[model samples]
Target chain A: MNPTKPTDDARKGDVVSPTKDKGWFYTDTVKDHFFHPRNFMQDESAYGEAAMGMVGSPACGDAMKIWIKVDPATGRISDMKWKTFGCGSAIASTSMMSVMVTENGGMTLEDARKLRPQNIMERLGGLPARKVHCSVLGDKALRAAINDWYRRAGQHDNIEIEQGRVIDATLKITDKDIEEAVLDGADTLEKVQAKTKVGTGDPSCIPEVENLIRFYKEKYFGAE
Target chain B: MRDIYLDNAATTALEPRVLDAMLPYFTERPANPSSFHSMGLRAKEAVAAARGTVAGILNSREDEVLFTSGGTESDNLAVVGIPRAYVAKGRHVITSAIEHPAVLEPLLHLQKKSEIELTVLPVDRFGMVDPAAVVAALRPETVFVSIMYANNEIGTIQPIAEIGKEILKWRKEHATPLPYFHSDACQASGACPLDVEKLHVDAMSVNGSKIYGPKGVGILYLRRGVALDPLVRGGGQERGIRAGTENVPGIVGLATALSLARQEMEKENARLIALRDRLIAGLLAIPKTRLNGHPTVRLPNNVNISFLDIEGEAAVLYLDAEGIYVSTGSACASTSLDPSHVILATGLSYEGAHGSLRFTLGKHTTADDIERVIAVMPGVVQKLRVMSPVNLDMKYFA
Candidate 1:
C-alpha cells in the first residue's frame, strides 16, 4: 500500500526512459532550473557593475560565481545573476539561489545574509544526497558578494563574516567545517582529521569529528 | 518534431530483416534446445546456424563461439573467467586503461580481491592504447590481456592486431601457457574488420545491440582450447563455458544483424566517416571547442568534442531537449557524477573532462542530421558557457 504508486501511463511503459521520472533522483523543480536557468549572466558585459563573489575551483569539479546589485534606498538585492560550472545540482542550486535573492522585490541585505543552503535546496525540492554540498556553495558565494557590496559602499563596520562554531579554535575547525571536509571525499574520520586537522589541535573534538564523519557518510552515501 | 538518434554507440535501432528472422524462433518454434525432441533439434540447429554465422564473421571455428547475454557478459566471461580458470599458471593480468567498464570493472574486482595483479596500460592523448606498453607489461605469470578494439567514448581505435601479435610472440618466447589475448570488439563489429585470425586474438567479444541486432545476445570467440571458468553454470549451453537455455530468437537476430552489417560495412563506413568529419569540423568551429579523439584513426560514426567552461551533462541535456540523443560519456557510466576516467587518462584537466560530450552516428544518421546538429550546437554551447562559473581567462582554471 504505497502512497506514491506509479501512474497508469508509467505502468503502460509510455515513459521511454526510466530517468525521465521527476522524482527519481532530482525533483522536477531542480530539473527546470537546470534546464532553463533564470537570470544567468549572458556575458561579462551583462553584470559588469554588479558585486561578484566566487567559491570552489575548477580543479575541484565545481565552482560558482554570483553577482548581485543592491538597491541603495532599501539595501535590498535589486538584481542577481550567477554562473556555475558544476553538475545539475550545483547549477540548479545557484540558479534557485539567484531567484530566491531577487524575487518578490528582492530580499534585504540582512535577509540575504541569513539565507542558508537549506533554504535554496528546499526551494528546488531538495538535491540528491551526495549533492547537498553543491547547495552549500550558493550561500557561501552570496555572503562573499554581500561582503563585496559592503566593501564597495565603504561600510566596513557593517560587513560581517560568519565564523563556524569552532570545535577546535587553534586549528579553526568547526563541526560544520568538518562536515564539509567529509563531503569533499574524506569518508573516514582519519581522512577528515588528516585533511582539516579538525581534532589535532584539541583532542576534545575528536569524538565530534568521528560522529560528523559517520553522519555525513550516512547522509551522502546512504548507510554504506 | 523529428528525433535524430545520434547515440548509436550506446545502442542502435534493430533492422527490419533481423527482426523478421527473429520472429519465427519466438512464436513458431519455441523449444528448449536441450530437450530430446524434434522441436529441440530444430532449435539446436537454429543456434548452430547462428553460431556458424558469427564464427564466419570472425573467421573462427564454429565450435569456438559461445553465446552470452550481451557485451558485458561476454567481457566478464573473458576477463574474470580467464583469470579464474588460469590463475595457477599466472596471477597477473594486463589491460588498457581505456577499456569499457565491462572489461575494466571485472579486472579491477579481481585486483581488489588480490586474486590477480592487474597492469592497466595507459592510453595516449588520442585514447589509443600503445602496443609497446602491452608488450612491456607481459609476464610469465600474466594469464590474460584484455583491451578494447575501439574506445566507446573517444572512439579511438587501438592497434588490437599488433597488440595480439606481440602477446603471441611473448607467449612463444617465454613458453607460458598463459596470457590469452581478448579484445572487446563490441563497438567495432559494425564498422571495423574483425577477423580473429588476422587480429591474432585468442578470444573476441561481440554483442548484438551495436550492430542493429537484438539486445539480449552476444558472442565470444574462445579460439577452441582457450580455457574459461564459466561465469554462469547451468544447462551446459555454449560448450559449458556459458550455461543457460538458448535464446533462439535473439541468437537468430544477432546472426542476421552481423551478416547485414558485414555486407554493408565498407560502404556504410565511408558514408559515416564523411558525416562524422563534417560534424567534427562544424562543432570545432565554435571558439574554445576541441575534438576529444584522434583526427583520422577514430571510429567513423563517433564525434566527441569538449566545450570550454560548460559541463558536458548540461550540453547533453540541452541536445536531448532539441530532440537529438547524445551522451556525456559511456551510457553505462552516465548515472555517476564523476568526470569520465577515459577523458582524464587522455591528460585533460578535470574541467575538460567535465566539459566533454560524445555524439555517435548510426546507420540512419544522415547529412541532414549532421547539418541540424551543427546549426543548433553553437547556440547551446554559447548558452551553457554564459552560465558556466569558470572564467577561461584564468590560466589555472582553464
Candidate 2:
C-alpha cells in the first residue's frame, strides 16, 4: 500500500509528517500532480462530447470532464485538458494524463488512444492499491477524449464505443446502468430499480434484471 | 515543521500530566490488579482510584465504572452485552442511524443472528434525532437503546438527556423496565456535561484517548441494576462483564485526563466554542461551502463544513500541506470509498458527504490557530473548486 520510497517518507522534518501516514495514500509523484495539476480545462464550453469518461456517480464523489484538440493532418493530439470532481489521485491521474499526451511535443492520437490505467499508474510512480480502482480515471477518460476528437472530426470509423446491452426498452437503461447502480451501492434488484428505473417500464426485463443484479453484485462486491 | 492538530475528535495528543500520573504504574508497579500481593495491591489501588474518579464524575457508584480497552469496547459491551443479558425480557433494540460502527455493527450482528429485532431511527437535516421521535420509536420489546451523545463526523450533540428522560417516562407509564439507555460519550467526554444522573442513561461510555488521556482505556458506567453479559472472558475481571487483566497505567491516565477535562471543561469549552465558531464562520464564507451539523446545538470543539464542488481528501491533503490537520467523511479517505454514514444521515447527498471536513478543537488549539486555518482554508477550497469539474449547486442537497 505504501509505494512511497523510504527516503521520502523518512524525511521526517518535512511538512508532511511521517506520523501522518500519508505514504499509505499515494506516492510523491501522485501527490505532486495532485497538488499542482496540469492542463486543467477551466473553460470547456467547446468540448461538448461529454459524460463518456467518468470515475463516480454524479450523486457520489468523483466525476471527470475531458477535452482534446487534435490536429487531423498530423494525426497528433496537439492539446489535452481535463477537470475532475475527484480525489487527489483522480485529479493527479488526470493531470498526469494531460501531461503524458501533451508534454515534450504531444503524442499522436494513435498513441494516446492506446494508453491504459497501468501506463498512467506506472508514470505516476503508482497509486495505492485501493486508489488504483477508483482514482485511476485518466487513461480511460483520455481514450474517451480521443474518441470525442474523432467524433468532432466526423471520422465515425475512428470512434471506439464502450458498448452496453440495452436493458430497459422504455427508459433506455442499459446493463451498464445496472452495473453503475450496483457500484453506487444498489446491491438488490429493488435498489437498482429505484435508482435506474430498471424492469419498471418493461416488466419483461425483470428476470434478466434480477440475474444481472446478482451477476454484478457478485462481480463488483463478490458473494455477499 | 509547523504542526497543528485539529483532529482531536479522532484522537487527542496525550496530556503530559496524564502521562505523569501513569508513569509510576507503567515503570515501577508492574503487578496486575488481579494479584493479591503488596505490589498487586498498589496496582489495584490505582485502578480503584481511577474507577472512583470515573464514578464521581458520572454520579454513579465506584463499582459501576468498568474499564475496558477504549470507546469501541465500552460501546460494544453496552450495546452487545446489555441486549444479550436481558434477552429474556424481550429482544428488540433501538439506535440512531448516525451511531459509531461499534454500537451499530454489534446490534446489526445480533439482528443478523435473529436474536433481536432492531430499529434504526433517522435524524433530521441537523443530524439530530428528535427526542419525541426517539420516544415514539420505543417498543415493548426494546431491551436497549444505544445512541451516541455526539456524532463523530458531524459533531452534533444529541439530546441524550432529553431522550433518556423520555425513555424513563415511557418506562414508568408502560410499567416496563425492558429498555436500558446507553450513550456513547466518547466524543462528548471532554466537552459535554456527562453526569449519568442528569443524563438519565442506564449506562454511558467514556473513552480516554478523546480526552487527552492514554489510548486503550475506557469505562462503562453501568447503573447498579443494569447487567451486562461478558464480551471478553478470562480472569473474571470487571465483575465478570469485561474480563482481562486491568490496564493500571492506562487506567490512571484515563482518570487523570478525565478529571482534568471535567475540571477545565467550562473554561476550555468557552475557548473552543469561540475557536470553533470562528473556524465555521471562516470556512462557510467560502463559496458553495455549508456547515454540516447544527450551528448552535453542536459540540463546542467541533466544526464540520462541506466545501462543495470538490473532493474531501483533496481539501484534507491541501490543508495537511499547509500545516493544518483535519478529518473528512469523504469516500476517498476510506479503503472502500464509502461516504460517511453520519453525514449522509443528515440528508446531505453523497457529494456533500464526500466533501465534508471536520475540524475538532482541543486544549492546545488557540485563537491564532483558528485564524491560521481561516486564512488558509478558503485558498485550499478555491484551489480545489477551480480544479473540480462539477458545477456548484446546493440543489443536489435537500
Candidate 3:
C-alpha cells in the first residue's frame, strides 16, 4: 500500500463527526514545501548568503537551519528560506515563515527580528497550543540567521569583545594540533609539549595537558 | 468517532468474563471478607481461590501471593518493604536505568530515610540490562537487586534468570549472606513466561489492568521469609506490607483475568508477535524509518519506530485522524515536554526520540489495524518530512 491514499471510508467522511467545537481545533496545511521545501538549501559558498545553523537541545525535539541571500547594496533580503527538522508544528511554522518571507518581498533584516510565534501560527490558520513552539522555532531560526549575518558583518563588536576571554583562553593553542599529536601515538607529556610549545617545566600547561590526555584516553581507549 | 485510547499500558479494557466474576462482590454480596458471616466467609474464599489462580500462573505457593491495589503499590511494597525489613543486613540496593518510575521513584525516596546506597545499572540500546553488570554491582553492603522483567516502553526482556543464578552464587560464596532480588514483572505477566523459581527472583510485581483485567488491583509475590517494611500504615490488610480496605471486586477481577490470560498466553503471544512483526516490517519499509528496540527479544506487540524527517506527535495525530491511536513514549510521563529518558539514555537525539511512536497490541488488535496504520504512515511521514524545516537532503528520505 502506498500509505498515502485515504481509504474510501476516510474520504467519504461522514463518519461520526464530533460537535463543531470538537472538530479539528487546528487543520494541517501544506503551507511550506517539505521534501523540496520552498526556499530550502543554501549555496554554502555563495558570496554573500547569510547562513545560520541552530542546534536545538535534543531534549526539545527539533533543530533548524536558515539562510538568506541579502543584497548588501539595498540592505533588503533577496531570498529567504529555512529547513527545520522536527514535529508537524515545527515544519509548518518554518514552512509558514518561508512562505511569509517570499510572499511579502523578503523582510529587511531588522523587520525579521520582530517575528513572533503567534504571527506565524495565525498566518498558518492556527497551531494547537501544544504545537505553538513549532512556530517559535521558525521565528527563532530567522532571528538567529539575522544575528549570524550581523555577526559576520562585524556589526556586533560588543559580543565579540565580551566573548574575547573564552576565545583567547581556548584558542591560545589550536585544539586540532593537540588532538592530532595524541592520535599520532604521542605520549601525553610529549603531545602537550608539542602542541603548547611549552616544555614539561611549565606548570600552567600541566592541567591543560593532563585534561587533553584524559580526553583522548577516554575517547579512544575508554580509559578515564 | 470515539476518543482515541492509546493509554492501554496504564490500564486496559476490562474483559467481560472478568467483569462478570466481580458483579456479585459489588451488588449481590457486599460482605467484608473479615466478617464472620457466611457471606463474608464466601468473599474470603474468593480471595483464597484467587490467590491459588495467581499463584498457579506464577508457579509459586499460593500463600506467597499478596494482593495489592496495582503495580505501583506492589512495586512500593516490594522495593521499599523488603529493603526496610533487612535494613540491618545492608543498605545498598541495585536496580536498572530504565525502571518504571514506580520502582525508580520509590527507590529514590528510600534513599532519603536511611543511608541506603543505590546503584542503577544501565541498559543497552535494546533496553536489555546486562546481568553481568548486576553481578558486578552487588557489594557486601548490597541489600537487594531489582530489575524489571521486561521494559514497558521498548519491550526488551532482561536476562533475569542468569542474574538470579549469579546472585545465588554470591550468596553461597559469602556464606549465607547475599542481596535479595526483585523484579517488576508487570509487563511480562501475560506476554511472557514467568516462572518465579526458575527466574530466582525473591519478589515480583504483577498488575491486573495490563492483562485485560479491572484496574486498581494487582499482586506482589514475596517469596516467603523475605522481610519488608509496610509502605501504607493502615488496617494491615496485606500481611502488614500494604494497609488498605480490601478491594474485593477488583481482586476477583484481577484473579479471573490472570487465569484467562495465562490460559491463552501461548496463542496470544504468537498472534500478537505476528501482528507486531508485520507492523515493524511495514514501517521499516518506509523511508527514514528506524526501529527503536531489539528485533527478536522485544515484546510481542510493541513496535516503536521513528520517522527521521517527521515529528512523532504529528504522525500520531495523523494516524488518530484515521481512527488509529498510539503513544509517543511511556504513558505515565507523556505529559512532560521532554522526550523519554529511556530513549535519551539509548543515545538518541531528542529529535529522534520525539519523532518516535509506540504501537502496542492487545487481545483485540488485528491485522487490519496494523494494515490501517501501515497504509497511512508513509504518506503522513512524507508530508511532514517535506514540511519540516530541517535541511535534510531529499535523497535522505526519498
| Cα-based TM-score, every candidate | 0.86, 0.87, 0.74
Candidate 2: give the clashing pairs: none
Candidates sorted by DockQ, best first: 2, 1, 3
Candidate 1 pairs with clashing backbones: none
> Candidate 2 on B340-395: residue-level lDDT in tens?
88887888876667788889888888898888999898888888888877876787
lDDT of 3: 0.70
Per-residue C-alpha lDDT of model 1 across residues A1-224, encoded as one tens digit per residue = 11122223222211235576442356778789988888888767867767888866654456778899999899999998888877676788888888899999999999998786656766776655445545666787888899999988999998886565667654444566666666656787655653444544356777877877888789877897
Model 1 Cα lDDT, one tens digit per residue, B252-272: 999999999999999999999
Q: Which wins on TM-score, candidate 1 or candidate 3?
A: 1
Going through the candidates in order, the fraction of native interface contacts each one reproduces equals 0.62, 0.68, 0.49
lDDT tens digits by residue: candidate 3, B1-398: 33434445656799999899999889988888878899999888888888888888889998789988889889988888888888888889999888998999889987876557888888787778887888888788888889998888777888889999999998999876558899999988888777899999899999888888988888999888888787788877767777776789998999898889889989999998898899899989986677776898987877887667556766776676667778777211243455677776666665566677888888888677777778878887776665455533323322
CAPRI-style class, candidate 3: incorrect
Q: Best TM-score goes to which candidate?
A: 2
Q: Which regions of candidate 3 deviate over 4 angstroms? A: A1-60, A67-81, A92-111, A118-135, A147-224, B1-10, B112-114, B330-338, B347-351, B391-398
Estimate the lDDT of model 1.
0.81
TM-score of chain B, candidates 1 onward in order: 0.97, 0.98, 0.94
C-alpha positional error of residue B67 in candidate 2 after TM-score superposition, expressed in Å = 0.6
Candidate lDDT scores, in order, read 0.81, 0.80, 0.70
The candidate, 1 or 2, that scores higher on lDDT is 1
